[model samples]
Target: MAAFVLRTHDYRTISRCLESYGLAVERSAATWPQRRFTDAAERRRAVATVTALGEDPAGTESAGYFHTRLHLAR
Candidate 1:
């Protein structure tokens, strides 16, 4: 499974058809953001399907940002 991230603004306008694949809206107040996915092929189809449904690529994300520390200051 794989999770893709997109801008919050774009997710707001995602089409319902695309939601069938995987649509989990993130709460603005959430302390930790999480994502879920079925598999690689599934996610691929989801992306393709969304485009077929006429959903803008910009608004295809259904999850929020996950906290990750790429750089740790000593």
Candidate 2:
């Protein structure tokens, strides 16, 4: 078996597809640095902050950050 991280915005759909392939999917508790905004408002606030700093929000990375681990069994 092998493990990998898949970054996606639509985890539910991807999880279903993985299940159909007989792969096990689970939310990992692994530690990693992930930048995230809790909600739309928070995201907007971040954009505003960056803009106030004279940076373009569009140039900066937007966060809808999600990751899941997959264990593939052979």
Candidate 3:
């Protein structure tokens, strides 16, 4: 399990990454601005997505941002 951050500017890249990872869009914010993913593959895909976006997973970007955490299902 891992975490990732994606910027809003590169949402297209993130969307592609999620699709490639076989993860579905769980939730999103329209006015406030937010996105979430629960699928494990999506999480991994997010890593690749963020990586492809050229932003450090541990760092922040100029336009958008994304964060992913280990889904500990209860």
Top-TM-score candidate index: 2
List the candidates' TM-scores in order.
0.31, 0.35, 0.34
Please list all clashing residue pairs in model 3, or write none if there are none: 5-66, 6-65, 6-66, 7-64, 7-65, 8-64
Candidate rank order under TM-score: 2, 3, 1
TM-score of 1: 0.31
Clash number for every model?
1, 0, 6
Model 1: per-residue Cα lDDT at residue 51: 55
| Cα error of candidate 3 at position 67, Å | 4.7
Best by lDDT: 2
Residue 39 displacement (Å), model 3: 1.6
Write down the RMSD of candidate 1 (Cα, Å).
Answer: 13.7
Clashing residue pairs, candidate 2? none
Q: Over the stretch 1-53, how does candidate 2's per-residue lDDT look in tens digits?
A: 44554332325665677788987776554423246667887677656654564
How many steric overlaps does candidate 1 have? 1
Report the error of model 2 at residue 66, Å: 13
Candidate 3 lDDT, 1-74, residue by residue in tens:
22232342355555556667776543332222245545656556655666676645444221233453222111
The residue-level lDDT of candidate 3 at 57 comes to: 48
Error of 3 at 11 (Å): 7.1
TM-score for candidate 2: 0.35
